[model samples]
Every structure is written in structure tokens, then in C-alpha cells.
Target chain A: MLSKDFVGGLITILLGSLYLFFAFKQRVSALADTVGPAGMPKFLGILMLSLGVILCVQSVVHSLKTNAPALVEWQGEGKRFFRAFGLLCLAIVYLVLVSILGYVLAITVLLTLVALYLGAQFSGQLATIAIGGAAILWAIFVLLLDVPMPSGILL
Target chain B: MDTILTLLPDSLNFYLVLPAILGVAWGIIGGSLPGISPSITMALLLPFTYALEPSMAIVLLASTYVGAEYGGSIPAILIRTPGTNAAAASVLDGYEMNLQGKAGLALGISLYSGVIGSFVGLFFLVMLSQLLAELALAFTPPAYFALGILGLSVIVSLSDQSLVKGLIAAVLGLMIATIGTDPVSGISRFTFGVSGLLPGIQPILIMVGLFAMSELFKQASILEDLRVKTSPRIRFPEKKLRKRLILPQSIGALFGGFEGVMPGAGGTIASFMSYNEARRWSKSKDEFGKGSPEGIAAPETANNTVAGTSLIPLLSFGIPGSNSTAILLGGFLVHGLIPGPMLFARSGDVVTDLYAGLFFAAIALFFIGYAIMPVCIWLVNKPRPYLNAFILALIMSGIYSINNSLFDLSIMLVAGVIGYFMRVMKFPFLPTVLGLVLGFMIESNFRRSLLLSGDDLSIFMDDKISLMLLTFAVIFVFGSLAKRLIQVLRAGT
Candidate 1:
């Protein structure tokens, strides 16, 4: 199996190559001064590619010397990764629905859902905490700080 | 004396005082919670500072740093869990003292030592920043570019074992910095036609996503025991105990003052070094780990000392040496203030105001550290889910408030995911942040110098300041590489 460094290095190489491609594609303005806009990006792209290769080489050398996989296995990491992914999905859902549901309602739902997902018991107390927390935040951000939160037909 | 009188009224003004106290109070609450680091705490507050006066915003961020250092000890003493990374050193003695039913005394010593350390750090910060700022007054474009390179070189030291990974992360950051309009040509490079991407991503957004959101994701996955057995009232040390603690506190101050100014060596290293040094020099070496007051005092003092001195590099050269200072730099940028030698020249009042604010923050820490204990304990005892949920809400709300644009929120989420992967991959974050913050400075200055010298590359070596700075960068990179090589060779043997 490929080591984490090897996988990470491959990803970086792909990213650097893509970035370099974009840098080259950037249209140079007639008024472009010395070095132009693409210069730094081009440099960064090559540097990243070089570093990725170095990392890949280093990992290979270390693995050969050890004669064993140096892969770090965190207990229940897969489960944890899924849990985090679930949380991210929930956040995305909230973002998509926020403007439609309005700030207060959307935030209240977010608070409740996040709490439940994180292992809080579903109860009246949880509802109260979620509703109350949303109200407080709304007051602080909207009324106090004068930041206009997204609003919809629903309160 | 004249300077003191001149700064006295501004420092004492209600605007500054209120923010100072409020910041410290908030910091203590955030810091006392396990897993909420000082950087995250400050990052959560970064957007809020957008609406604040520049001086007040800076003071608020700076004071949070001061309070967080002391706040970290509360959990370290009470629950055997370090609230911040720096507080890890305090756990050895602090938890032992708690087990021995001397928790109050340990807390007191930590607080007292922290204040002493802050004052010591403040003295050095004031003396050194002024001198460095003065020296940096002659910086040309090439010199600024060299300074940025020098800042980037700090990444070598920051990359604990993997220099390659650190450089990759930094390169990624520089790439992100390139996503907006080009500085010189006024043409969009990588915006991909998104109007929001035209201004580029705000550093604060990236910071909050990386430090706060990614940590939340990690915390959501892990189940930890957050129970506290008891809340103890703090007891100030008696005369005899105070005398005994003096030596360790001094040692902590010395180590902290040195480490705080050095790029990439923050409170964590300083605290650990102080603990080791304090034990080595102690008369009660046998009691060092087993509830020795000096043990708690040394590490606590060192971390808080770093709170003040860490600002030295940021103020003098616009280079943040640690995560917390980077957030503070974000605070400065939000208010259209750029911190450096020119900062002192253009906004000298802001610099003086920061000094005043720090002095007041130290004083506030003493009182707030005591008064807010019950609250800190109460907060720590809360269920993890609710706390995490509220924090997530705060992050979303804060990110939206920055531009009232949903696009920024999306960017933040993307950055958060990237940060999560980086954490899993064991890439150091400071390098990425440094690259993001310094990317423009490096690129613009490099091009500006070349343009001025008619595309001559030697302009970098021609300027005295630039030459000196470049030399330092070379030494730093080479030195770190050499050290790493030796470690690898020794391991092979």
C-alpha cells in the first residue's frame, strides 16, 4: 500500500501541475510590468511540484530502509472521518436552506441538528437551548452589530 | 516618563478599557475550554473586530492572548487536561496538586506567575520592538521582499520533521493568494469569473476555517471525558511560597522572552523548556513533578510571558511568529492598518495604544483570572455537543458578517475541508498561514524591485538591508536543514 506521504505527494503534484497549467493560460496584459501576473504562480507551481517529488522520494527511501509499512493507523479513524463528513453534509444543507428558511429558523434547526448529530439527547431542554441560543445570536449579530442576516418569508 | 504621560490618558480611556476587559473575559472562557486554542479563540473574534475601532480591535485581540495563556491552566489544574498546547507542561504538577487537594494554591501560583511573566515580556517587547522598527525604517522594496523571504524561512524550523510537507502547504497557500486580481496588471488571474473571488479570500476567513472549523470537525469525531470533580477557590500564595516561586518564575520569564520573539518558537516550546530548566535548577528536584508549586509556576509564567513578547516581531516587521499573532495581524489588516516600521511612522498612536492595552491586559488578567474561575469551570462542565454547536453557529455568523456575502461562507467551508485534510496529513498550519499572509508582500516587492532596477536581479543583493535580510534567510534555511540531516543520520545509525 502507498504511504500517506506518497499519496499526499501525488495529490500535490497533480495540484501543482494544474496550477501551472492555469498560470500559463493566463492572458498577459499589454501593460504588464516586469514579471507579470503569472510569474509568482508559475514559480509557486514549480516549487510545489519539486517539493512533492522530494516528499515522495523521501518516503520511498524510508520505507525501503525500514522494510515495513510505516503507515499510521488511528483507531476508528474511518468512523471518525464519516462522522465529520456527516457534519459537513449537515452544514451544507443548512447553507442551502438558510436563505429560504430565514436566519432564525435556519439557525435554530442547525443548532438542534448539530447537537443531535454530536450525541445530545433529544429533549425539551435541547429545544430550549437551541431556540434560545439562536435568539441570542440573532440579537448580537443583527441588532447589536448591525449585520443584516439572511431573511425569508418565514420568521 | 514623558512617553508614559503621553500614553496614559489614551490607555485609560473607556473605549480601550472596556474592550481590554471584555476581550480578556472572553479569552478566559474560550481558553478554559479544552480543544479551543488561543488562535481559534482569537480567530472566532476576528470578524467581530471588523466593526471596532482599530486600537480597540487590536487591544481586544491582544488581551485575549494574555488571558488565554492563564486560562489554559484552569483545566490543566482541575481536570488534568491542558486547555491550550502551552498548558501541557503545567499538567505534570498542576494535576498532581489537584490530586493532593492543593488545587487552589496551584491556580494562584499559576496566575501570579503569569502576571509577572507578562510584565517581563512587556518590558522586553517595548524595548526591542522600538529598536527593530527603527532599524527597519530604511527598508526598500527589495528589503521588504527579503524580509518576506526571511519570514518564509521560519517554516523550515516550524516543520517538525517534514520540511517537504511544510513547503508544499506553504506553496498551496501562495497559490490561494494568487486566486484574485493581479496587483500590477489589474487583471484577474484565477478568479474563474466569480466576483467574490476578485478581492481574493480574506486571511481571517481562511484562519477561522482552518483553526476553528477544522478543530470542530475533529472534536465532533472524538469522545472525551469533560467532567470536573470540583471547583476550588484560588488561594494567593503566602510570603514563604512566593519567595520559593521567585526563581522558577524568573527562569520562565527568561525562556519565554527569548522564545517569543523567535519565529516559530511559541508558548508551547517556551513553557516546556522553562519546566525542564526550572526542574534542573530547583532545590526540590524530587518534588518537581509531584505537586511542586514551582513546577506550575514556571510553565504558566513562560506561556503568559509569550503572550506579550510574541507581538514584538509582528509590530516591528509585520511578521507574526505564531498562530495567535497571525490572528492579531488579521485584526490590524481589517482596520486598514498595516503593522511594520511604516506602521509606527504612519500610525504611531496605534503602536502606543497597543502598548497601553497590553499593560492594561496584564493587570486585567490578574483580576479576570480570579473573578472568572467559576464561569470557566461552569463552561468546562457543559456538554460537548451544545458547546460545539454554538461555536459552529458563531463561525458561520461571523464569516457572513464580514461581507454579508454567502460566497465568503462557501470559501470558508472549502478552506475548512482543506484544513481538515492537512490536519490528518500532519502538515504544519503555520507555514500555510505564513505563505498566505506574506505572499503578496513577497511577490509585489520582488516585482517592484526588479522593475525599479530595470529587471536586474542583483537589486536584491545591491541594497544593504535586502542583502542582510536575504543572508539571514539563507542561514535559517540551511541551519534547519543541517539540524534535520543530523537527526536523520543519527536515527539511521
Candidate 2:
């Protein structure tokens, strides 16, 4: 099986190809005008294409030469990945709901959800994390730093 | 230097007192915490400085920069976990000495080296930056374009696993850079008619996204498995280890200074290189990887040394030496201060205050270093899952607070996703961000240089400095290609 490195390389190469195509179209202006804005991009597009070719060649060579199967290792925890992703989604939802529910309420709920989702090891640490996060945000942004955060109608 | 001194007297009362104490405390706490960088601390404090007298604000920011470098060493020596990337090298020998029961000796060596490097770098920053700024007055648009290209070439050395992927990411960043308004021709390349894209992406938001928020996204994914399981034990170093560390630390500081002067080389490079150098030069090289005092001393000294002198280019020219300094540039701009020759002549008071603060900040760091060492050791060695979650929460809140814009939050999430994939594939992300920042600088300068010379291609080759910079860029690119070729040949063999 091909490794993540190999797959990632292929993906990048495809993206580079699309960019190169657009850059080539723009190069007509570079050829016609003096100091065309397209010169650098055209140069970069060609350079990227060359790099993409090299990576593709290297990946093919590695696939051919290796006798043993490509190693697949999970670098770290799957549970952690899910928890972080879930919390991130919750943040997005909070952002969307903040306009309707108000900034303070949305942030308070988001903090509580994130603290719990992050798996605070201590029994009542969830409350501490939530309160602490909210307090710090309020003090730093709302009061001192003067950044405008959402204020819910309830607040 | 005379100009800097003349303005020192007028602001003596304000610059000397409060900023020093506040800066040192901030540095200690920020430095002790893993993943908190001094640059971010300065950026957060930047907005408040707008309300203060110029001298006071600059003084406070400079002090924080110096104090943070020393603060990072505490955790490295105690827990075998470095608080910042710069301190990562220190853990090798420092933790080994701790295992052998000589934590005090290791701490002593780190403190001593930190002070020495700080003093040396300060002396150079004061003297050399002034001299360079004078020379920088002669720089033209063509010169800046060449310098930008040279800076971008440094990315080759930074690519971790796949140079190809790194190059692609860099090019992509450069493309994104073209999306804003063009300075010379006034024709936007890819702004796509979005009014918000007119001013281009702010450097602070990009950095906050690239460094801070993206980091939290990746950390969040690892929150489940990141349990603090280490048992805490502290012991002062033996007399023998103390004697052994002095020479190694000195050697590390020398390389650290060299790294600082070179643009694009930051703490990570300095620490790793100096650590390896110390091992190579040591009598008990085999003790390295296992536990050696020299291993820790070399890297700790180098990291701090690099941290101070890295400001040389940022101050002397308008160029940033590292990611941290790039963010610092935003702070400088926030105060309506441009960092080059204009500031030297126009805002001399601010310059003097910054210099004074930097000098005292190093001194203040020594005290903070000792006081916080024990706590840092405990924090790292003691397992506390709750603290990690707290840190994660802090990172999220801090990033969100920077720009109340929901769009920036989304950008942060997208950058985080990109960062995660890059890290997993062993592709270097630093180069991508650096390329992005430098891309606009290069494009604007290149176009202006062309327009200045009536599109003459000979102008780039005409200037001596531009010639030298382009030469270096060619060498770096070819050198990267050669290395890849050699690797391929070895693989074939």
C-alpha cells in the first residue's frame, strides 16, 4: 500500500498542475507588455511544475525499489483527534448561533462544551476550565485589550 | 549610537521603572509555559502600548523579548521536555544531569550562559544595528527584491521530509500573496473584486493563524493521549557536571550568535546544530543521547544567544529574521514606527528606551530564571491532564480575541487543517508561511525595480548587493537539488 507521504505528494502535484495551467494562460500578457505582472507567477508556475514532476518520479521509484510493504503507523491517539474535531465543530456552531442567542451566552456554552469534550481529568475541573476561560476572555478582550467580542442579549 | 544616547536622558524616568518589572514577570510565565512564545506575548501587549508614551511602550516590549529567552530554559532542564522549541535541545543534557541528580548544577550553567549570551548579543545589537542602518540608507528597490528572493531560498534548508511538498507550499503562499492590490501598477492580480481583500492579509492574523491557532487545532487532536505521566524529582548538579558544562555552553553560544545574524535561521536551527556540535566536540560523545551535561548546556546557550541577536536584521533593515520577529513587526507598525533608518533618526527616544529595556531585561531574566525554575520543573515532570485542557482553552481564547472577525476564525481553522496534514506528511510548514509573507515584498519590489529602470533586465545584475543576493539564491536552490539527487542515488545504491 502507498503511504500517506506518497498520497499527499500526489495531491499536491495535482493542485500544482491546476495553478500552472492558469499561470500559463496569464503569461501571454507577460510576453506582450513591458514588466508584465505575470512574470513572477509564470516563473513560479514552471518551477512548481518541475517540482511536481520530481516528486512524482521519486514516489514511483520508491514504490518500485521497495521489496517490503510500506509501513503504516498511527502516530498518536484516535480519541484525541475525534475530541478535538468535535470541539472545533462545536465552536463553529457557537459562532453561527451567537448572533441569535447573544455573544456571552454562546461563548459560555461553548467553553463548557469544549472543557468537557477536552476530557478534564479531575471531577469538577470542567467548571473551572469553563469559568476560567470565560473570565480570561472577558478581562483581556472586553475590558483591557478592548477587542469587541459578542455580547449576548442575556448579558 | 550617538542619536540613540542623546534621546535617552529625556525619557529616563518613565523607561527605567515599571516596564522592567512587568516585562520580566510576563516573560517568566510565558517562557515557562509550553507553546507560548515571547512574540505572541508582545503582540498581545501591543494594543495597550498605543495608549502609553512611545518610550514606555517600546521599553516594555523589548524587556519581554529578552526575559522570555531565559524563561524557556527552566522547563527544559527539569522535565526533559522543553517549554519552547528553542529549549528542546537543552533537555538532552539537562534531563540527563537531573537523572544523575544534578538539577541545580544544570540550572546554574543555563542561567550563567543565558546572561553571557544576552550581554554579548546586546552589545552587538547596540553597536552593529546602528552601523547597518547607516548602510541601509543606500538600499534601492532592486536590492530589496534580491534580498526577498534570498530570504525565500532559505526555505530549502527548512524542508523536513519532502522538499517538493515544501516548494509547492511556498509557491502556493506566494500566489496567495498576489491577491492584494499592486503597489506600482495599481492593478490587482487576484483580488477577485472582494473589497475586504484590498489591504491584503494582515501579518498578525496570518501568524496567529499559522503559529497559534493552527497549533491548537493539531493539539486538540492529541488532547486525549497527552497525559502528564512523569514523576517529579529535582536534584542539583554535581561539581563534576558543572565543570564539564562551561566549555560546551560557550561553544553553543558562539554558533547561536552566528545563526542570529543569518536571516531565516531561528532558534530551532541554532539549538539543534549547536547540540550536535557539542556532542561532536565532546570527549564523552557517546554519553550524548543517553544523558550528558554538555548536551544540554550547548543547546541552551545557543538558543538564548540566537534569540537576542536575531533582532539585528529586524532593527537594522526592515527584514524579519524569524517567524517571531515577523509578528514583532506588526507590533512595531501598530505604534506607527517603521523599524529601519527613519525610526533611528525620527524616533530616537523610542530607540534609546528599547535599548535600555533590552539591556535590563536580560538582567531581570536571571532573577526570574532562578525563581521560576523549580515551578517549571514541577509543571513538566508532574502529570496534569487538566492543565493541558486549560492550555488548549487558553490558546483558543487568545486566538479568537485577536480579531473578533468570524472570518479570521475560519481562516485559523483552515490553516490548522493545512498544518496538520503537512506535519503528518513530514512537510515543513514554516517555509510556507515565510514564503507567503515575503511573497508580496518580493513582487512589489521587483515590479518597482523594473518600472524604475524602464523594464531593464540589466538593473538586477548591475547592483553589487543584488548580484550577491541572487548568487546566494541560485546556490541554495542548486544545493537543494544536489542534495535530493544524492539521496536518490543512495536510495538506488
Candidate 3:
């Protein structure tokens, strides 16, 4: 029901509060300067908190003046958010598998699965592109650039 | 000039030449893709620079910027979509010209105008950056602190609709910056016992995550556009058309030269302003949007000119005015080269090498732009799924190569999610990046100035340079606030 600005402001406030708590907890040394190490962090925290409050106030004022709820909505917003979340999950899976499966295998599997996930047909052509693409990347990163890749269980 | 001859031998080196050509080729390919921005294109290349010499690495990144700016027009002319934000204005007359079967001519004019703009931008960059750097030589700790504040002040302009949100984003970035170590003291602040956190989260990781990975995430949710397969040959403008284009190109160059130097007023704005001005000045103003050569010439020239002139701030003041230049600044940091007045004194050769590299990039843009046309068409026509998948794979691989640590990869993915939410929230990324990049400098200098004055705040007012920069920052912030207030009042009325 809240506007995006109101929600965002709340989140910023939460973050600022947490940051301020940690900043206050930071230890200072006897040799530390007059303002010390925690000074900027403390300043940034207060600044963020103040700005967040201002944003919240502004959003509330705007809603009151317009006499509207200002509910945030976008067409297909949920679907898009979920789809993006899915891709991120898949990337996380790739990261976990990468150390176990090695760079070439993990990356090849990632390429194929992501392609299919994004609406590619499960054809031999897709296979070739995925395999070929992974191999080429391998050659470029490991061979030409001389940068090491995660070897893992399989070469 | 004696400067040119002195730098000639270094310019002719094979190491520099190869990166310039390769960077341009890669940039044209990357930029011609609709979703790939110049910053993302450059960020994708950031990890690879670890193996390169400092000069070579900087050249590669800088040249990519040059190529990418020009490359954006390919899609603007061929398809209705602009490849980069700056190329959006080109879509009007560019696509119109394509529709009228003058696609090749349109392509030629874009390329030609872009080169002219590049040369013009380079002239200003060479002339002005040195002068500015000389002026900045007198900077004290307070002055540097004020400089950082001045850089951060651009956030007000960067924030589209909300100063509060922009300040919030910048504060968040500053918080992230504090996670590594306390600059004045030897104590660590908020590392949470993670070894990787000690390095304070590399700006490149944040950049690649924010710009490239977040873009991919967004693309995943959207339906891919149906590919249009048409290979339009490029044809250079004849003498008559060239003469006609001169006025519009000059207008673009001047606008771009000025805009590129201002923080946050990047290529997109310059292109639009140049297009409008060119229309106002044109004798055949009636043809402004109906496939007018001037329309294509103006925006294209302005955007490409921005590729050179945008570096002026980065070179002179160590301040990155745009996303692409921020990535370039990352390149400099990667090489242990700090950009600023001290940079000129310490690494003058690198500066000269950059000049040489940009010169090579401009020449390479002319030749490579023609030869790479078919490749650009073919690449863009490929299935969106394959392109997205490969790009993701590239990002993952590139992030791993940085420290050979999986922790960095995780951090990058987290940053990507933050970037995605930031996009959804309508929060700008540049201010956050500016904060992250400039945070340490601001904090260190602020503390140092205070230490010198025994915690007295008046030391900032005591120094002339510091006073001047702080006054500028105040003007920028208040000016932005006043403008926002006016808009709010008008809306209420």
C-alpha cells in the first residue's frame, strides 16, 4: 500500500540505524587522531538517517496533498521480479558448482541452462553453441590470457 | 608540436597499437548490442587488465570508450533502438534515413561526424586538462577534501527526482567504504572477520555487478526483440554533403566539449542539446526530424566527442564525470596509477601514452567501424538467450579471474542484487559510485585537515583553494535544491 519512496526511506532508515550502532561500537586507539576512525562513519550514519526521514516526510506530504494512496504498481512487476530472482538463484548454483565441477564444465552447464531458461529450444544447435562458447572462453581465459581457472575435480 | 614528437616513439610501440585496435574492435561489437552500455563493455574488460602494462591497460579501456560511443549509432541507424543512451537522439533521423533506403549514407555520416567530434574533443582535452592540472597543483589536504566534496556534489544533479534518495545512496556507498580499515588509525572498523573485506570491496566488482550483471538480470525478465537482419553498406559523404555537415558537426563538437567536462552532464544530454541547436541553426530546419543528415550528424558527433572530452575531469582532477570514465578510473587504480596533479608529475609518460593511444583509437575507429559493420549486424541478430547466457558466463569468469577467490564472486552477485533493487527504486548509481571512489580521499583529507588545525573546522576556510572548491560544492547543492523546490511549487499550483 505504501509508495516506493516511503518504503525505500524506511529501508534507508533501518540501514542507517544499524550503521550508526556499529560505528559507535568501533574501538579507538590511544594514538588515534582527534576525530578518530569512527568520525566519518558516524557522520554518514546521521546524514543517511536524516535524509531518510526527510524522504519519508516528503512522500507523506505528497500523498496527503494529492489525496491519493500513491500505491506503487507496475504491470507484470511480480513476474519480472521473480524471473530476475530465478536467474540470480541459477547464478548462485553456478558459483557453488563451479568449484566442484571446474570452470569449463560449470560454465558450459551454466550457458546451456541459462539459454534454455531464457527460452532457447533444447536442440543440438543449442548444445553446440553452449559447448563451443564455453570452450572458446576457456581458451581465451586460461590459455591466451594466462589467467588460471578453477580446475576442480575434472580438467 | 615538440610534445607530439617526444611522444611519437612510445605511440608507435606494438604493445600500445595492438590494444587500441583490439579495444576498438571489441567496443564496436559490445556497443552495437542494444543492452550493453559503454560502461558495462568497459567493466567486462577490467579484470583482464591485471596482466597488462599500466599504459597498455589504460589505452585499452580508453579506446573501448571511444569505439563504444560511435558503436551505439549502429543500432540507432539500423534498428529503431539506440545501443547506448547517448545514441537515443540518433534514432530519430537515423532510423528515418534507414527507412528511406539511405541507411548506408546514414551510417557513413555517423561515422564521419563521430571522427570529427573525437578530434575536436581531443583538442580541448589536450589543451584544458593540463591547464587544470597545473591549477590543481596547489591543492592541500583541505583542498583535496573540498575537491572530493565537489565531486560528491554532482550527486544532486545525478539524482533524477529525489535529492534525499541520492544522498541516501551516497551515504550507503560511504558506509561500504568504511568497511575496510580506519585510515588514521591502524584498527580495522567493520571487516566482520572476513579477509576479503580488508581490501574494502573493489570498485570494479561493484561496477561489473551494478552495470553488467544488473542489466543482464533486467534483460532476463523482458521479452527479447525480434531480430532484424539487414546489412547496410557504409558510404562516406561526398564533398557537398560533407560541407553541409560541417556546421552541425561543429555545433555538436562545441556542445559535447562543454558537456563532457561537467559532472553528470554526459553524452546523452550533449547529443540532445546539439540536435536541438543544430535544428535551430539549420537553413533547412523543416527537415530536422524527417531523415535530415544534420540530425544524425549532430547527435552522433556530440556523443563521440564526449568519448574524449569526458576524460578531461578524470585526467585533471581524478574525478570521473560519467559511468564509463569511472571504469576508466578503476583501470588507473588497477595499475597503481593515481590520476590528479600528482599523476602528471609522477607518471607523465602514462599521460602521453594515453594521448597516443587515443590518437590511435580515433584512426582505428574510422577503419574498424567500416570493417566491423557486418559483424555488428550478425552479432545483434543472434538469439537474445544465447547472448545473455554468454555475457553472464563472461561476467562470472571475469570476476573469478580478479583474485582467484570465490568470495569476490559472491560479493559481486550481492552487489548485482543491490543494483537491481536500486534500479527498481529509481535510485541513481553514479552518485553511489562517486561516493565509493571518493570516500577514502574525502575522509582521509577531512581528518588530516582537522589534525593540522587541531580539530578546528576553520582550516577549510583558511585555504583559498579549499574555500573556492567548498563554495562551488555549496552552490551545486543549493542550486539543485532550489530547482527541485521550483518544480514542486509549479506542480502544486
CAPRI level of candidate 2: acceptable
lDDT of 3 by residue, B1-493 (tens): 5556766787788888999999998898888999899999999999989889999999999999999999999999898888999999999999999999999999999999988887788777887877786765688999999989998999988887787888888887788888887888868888878877876888888888988999989999997775655788999899999999999999999999999998788999999999999999999999978999999999999998899999998998888989999999999988888887678878988988998888888889999999999999999999999999999999999889888889989999998998998888788888888898899999999999989999999999999999999999999889988988899899979
TM-score of chain B of 2: 0.81
TM-score of 2: 0.84
TM-score of each: 0.98, 0.84, 0.97
lDDT of 1 by residue, B280-351 (tens): 999999998899999999999899999989999899888888999989998998898888768888898888
**lDDT by residue (tens digit), candidate 2, B1-493:** 5744643564355546578667766766667666667665564455455556666776676666666676676667665556677888877777777667676777777776777677667766777777876755566778888878877787776565667777877876786676565555555555556776777665555555556555555656663322223433333346776677767877877788888887667777888998888888899999897767677678777877776688887777656667667666656765777665456767766766777776676777677666765565455443334444444444445555655666656665666666666656666655676677678778878888877888897999998878987998899889877987898899979
* Candidate 1 lDDT, A1-155, residue by residue in tens: 37778778888898989998999999899999868998898988899888888888987897798776555544477788998888898889889878899888999999999999999999997999899999999999999999989996676
Candidate 1 CAPRI-style tier: high
Q: What is the lDDT of residue B231 in candidate 2?
A: 34
Pairwise lDDT winner, candidates 1 and 2: 1
For candidate 2, write residues A1-155 as lDDT tens digits. Answer: 36655666676767667666665554234333465666677777777777766776777677677744545434453564665577568668776866666655566567666555655543455666566766776776678767676665656
How good is the docking of model 1, as DockQ?
0.82
In candidate 3, what are the lDDT values of residues A1-155, reduced to their tens digit? Answer: 37778878898888889989999998999999988988888998899888888989988898888777565445476799999998999899998898899999999999999999998999998999999999999998999887788888886
Which residues of candidate 3, in runs, are more than 4 Å off? A67-69, B483-493
- Note the chain A TM-score of all models in turn: 0.92, 0.71, 0.93
